[model samples]
Target: MPKSNIMDTYGRFDVIFKKGIGCKLYDDKGTEYMDFVSGVAVNCLGHSNPAIIEAITDQVQNEIQISNYYWNDKAVKLSNRLTDLSDHEAVFFCNSGTEAIEGGLKVARKYGKIKGGNKKNIIIYMDNSFHGRTMGALSVTGQKKYQEDFEPLIGGTTNAKFNDIEDIKSKINEDVCGIIIEPIQGEGGVVCADSAYLKGVKALCEKYDALLIFDEVQCGVGRTGSLFAYKKFDVIPDVICMAKGLGAGFPIGAVMTNKRASVLTHGDHGSTFGGNPLACAVGCAVLDELVDNKILDKVDDKSDYMVSKLKKLKEKYNIIEEIKGMGFLLGLKLSIDVSEFSKRCFEHKLLLITAGKDVIRILPPLNIEKEDIDKFIIKLEEVIKTF
Candidate 1:
């Protein structure tokens, strides 16, 4: 990237993808690669899906952009669909995951202040967690590395350990407004919170009258073989943030809230281009493919197959330390250096992404074919042999 034109925040790869279909991607020079990352799990139905294409073509022709001053049919449809799929009573759209997190936090604060007055401003997060990079999101993000230089973020944010119910319980106080957590820690190496632990957290939140927020941006919209990862556990959060795959491939995020959000009178939070016609139309189409067409029903078998194959590879190669994550979001913990291995995989025409510090994450498109998975295994085996 030229410094004159573009910023250098992301350590992006050199390859420029020109096109993609299903789980297959092609570079500008027409070199085909098996895409296992799916744009970091954004394209749930894969690239240029027929449904999204139709939605985009039609909606772009009708209306591309609009201010939030007026209501639109597509926005209402998308919001209704999302709220129907989840336990939320209402939804708020935003531009990205970080924005969604920020919106949720704001709602929690507003709701808390109404219930307990000004003292209830504290929000608790987890260690090794990632919500987003925006200031409000960053304040609650647990890792100090991401929050250090941007010191003095929004105050009243605390940290707790994953799966440690006692630690979470100890942090609960009258001043605490809410607690946010990822049902599955996608950026934190695909770590899954135990069911019992989530239940305990919910109980604690109730005991303290604190709102519970689940950050499902990376694991929602059937990415985890369900509409949202929160369904895996029996507990329900008062507020939840979703993005990444929510709009198929469009840029959109939403904050879903239960009835507790009634405390938010008006103008508590808003976004200008959040639920515009183009994005909402695409979101509706994505939901049609996943929910109406029953595409997610096929994810279980595919996830099981992926796990079976990965374990087989583990049995064959001792370099594999363990397999983590649930459903389609998987991670391979390796005893060997992953940077060189991932680079080799890229050179071998297999796209992959790493998580945390030591794990290789596989967040492929949800509808990837079995043969494509086999091909991924073949390429992975070939790449591992070189190490």
Candidate 2:
């Protein structure tokens, strides 16, 4: 390989994928590989999807993007569709997951000042949660490593233990403005929030006059067999930040706010290219495929099948310590080094993203069939047998 000009931010893999189809990818040399990472759970419908392609092609022929100053048809349609499905009444489109989280925070803080007599600016986040990497989003991200180098983060934030309601309650105060958490912690090893815990947090937020923000950037948009994971848990949040699968790899994100948290007046928050025509059109198409076409209808069944197979593997292989998460955003806790395991899987033409210390994430396309999962299991077995 020639000396690279790209920044060394990412620890990239050796193989450069040139093309991809459903649940599969092709390297520059045309070598086939099964994809379980799904662009870190972005390409929920799979790569080069017909609907997404058609939508983007048609959109480009007409218009791609315009300043948010003027309203656009596709953006309006997408906003309407999202609000209709979600509990929120308003939507703010952005470019990525981090931007969505940042926007949600701004909405929360703005609502707090207006509703809470402008006294509360403090926000609470949970341990092991990954909201995003941007400065505002990073402020709520619970991992210390990501925050170590970047000190003096957005102030008035506290980190509570995941699933520990008392820890959350202990940190809540009169000045608390918002509390953000992931319904399922994606970068934190696919940990799930306890249903009762989430309910308790909701009640506490209500009592404290704080906004509840659900960071569904990784687990939303049919990844967890629902439009959003919070909806599946049946716990309503004041603000919901979503991306990743929202555009099915088209690079779009959104922040939804309920009536109570809709305190941000005009000009409080804005994005130049947020709800651009092209991204919104792709978002609309993805929504259509997931909702109208009933692509997510079979997700629960598929997740069940995959989990059962993983359970069998756990019983047979002692290296398989545990299986965590729900639906397609699953993880395998391994006794062995997951980094090495993932590397070996990559060498074997199977892709897996490692999460946390020893968890291997099993994020496949939402529309992936059981047959593809079976193929994944077969490949996983081969990788383990030699390990």
Candidate 3:
């Protein structure tokens, strides 16, 4: 075999995309694709959205960044909007979902140290939960594949089975300080925790004085037909970690916390480009569109339509085992290998991705058009025929 020029980190796809507009993307050869992946749920408003482009461009013309040493109007405004939308009393911005997770962990540990001393540093995480790739985030990421070589991971983290209250309760102890979970597990095959299960977790957290942290990095920012997925369950968390769609393609992440868990004093945690003006400007624009344009309500309608189509497809194709997730963040379990089905869909001009071994993850832009969805269904049907 010949050596490849590029580093082999990601499983490389052959197709090269040249440009994207709305829910469709064009390859270098001008072939078009119905993009259901949406950059793994990052491009919430679709590609090259006018509002996002205009906001980013205008901000660049004026100012792009300012150190935390000085005040930035856009950052302040974005923080205010985020805090106002949730029960959280404060917000800390960062560049990616992982950074936000890192910040959240720091806050949790700091709170433990301040209130319970250093002994109470243990944090509970779900078995299949994914926080991030960074050390602190990776430490709590319960998947072993990502942690295989990383020895001596941040200590004081334990894994409990998702949706099993007994398993979670068994793991909790006096040393535990927090319990972090994805309201809807995005990367772990789109498994949603039962509402009763979430409520039970909340009760456990309350009983043990453990902070509840919702990692809505993928299923948040109006992806689940609400500003945050926790809202759907009516369970407010002590700290909420969000990213992906918050900036609608621009790099931004935030940790939103209510007053009780807002224990970080000055100099406890900080980031260099955490709340830069440009990213916040884009974040505010995305939020305004989500709220003022009533985009949140549309998420449920579109999700229902997609689910209906998928159910019909499921009947026709025995390969499909189940459909899971809320609103637009859907997962399709397959009797066949998901990688094979995903490749078939991609070859048929429909972009898709695999979540776990046998799950087809569909994360189209929140504002995707109905026509494009219909076309995707047609293309998917064609792909399933060959599969």
Q: Which ten residues in a row have the lowest lDDT in candidate 1?
A: 1-10
Which candidate number would show the highest lDDT if scored against the true structure?
A: 2
Give lDDT per model, in order: 0.89, 0.91, 0.90
lDDT of 2 by residue, 143-190 (tens): 898998998888878889999999988999878989999999989999
TM-scores, each model vs. reference: 0.98, 0.99, 0.97
- Top candidate, metric TM-score: 2
Model 2 weakest lDDT span, ten residues long = 110-119
lDDT tens readout by residue for model 1, 1-387: 324457668777787888998888998889999988888989899987999999999999999778888889999999898888878789888889999999989888987888799999999999999998989999988888899999889888888998899999888898888999999998888899999999999988888899999999998889889888889777789998999898877999999998876455567778889999999999999889988898899998999998999999999999889999887899999988887788989999998988888899998888888998899999999998987
Candidate 3 TM-score, true structure as reference: 0.97
The runs of at least 3 residues in candidate 1 whose Cα sits more than 4 Å from the true structure, single-residue gaps closed, are 1-4
lDDT of 3 by residue, 1-387 (tens): 246787877886787888999999998889988888988989999999999999998999998988898999999999998888888889999999999999889878887787679898999999888888999999989799998898779889999999999999899977789999999888888889888999999999888888999999999998888988899988989999999999898999999989989988789888888899999999999998898888887989988999999999999889889998988899999999888888888888899998877799999999887888898899989999996
Each candidate: RMSD: 1.2, 0.9, 1.6
Clashing residue pairs in candidate 1 are none
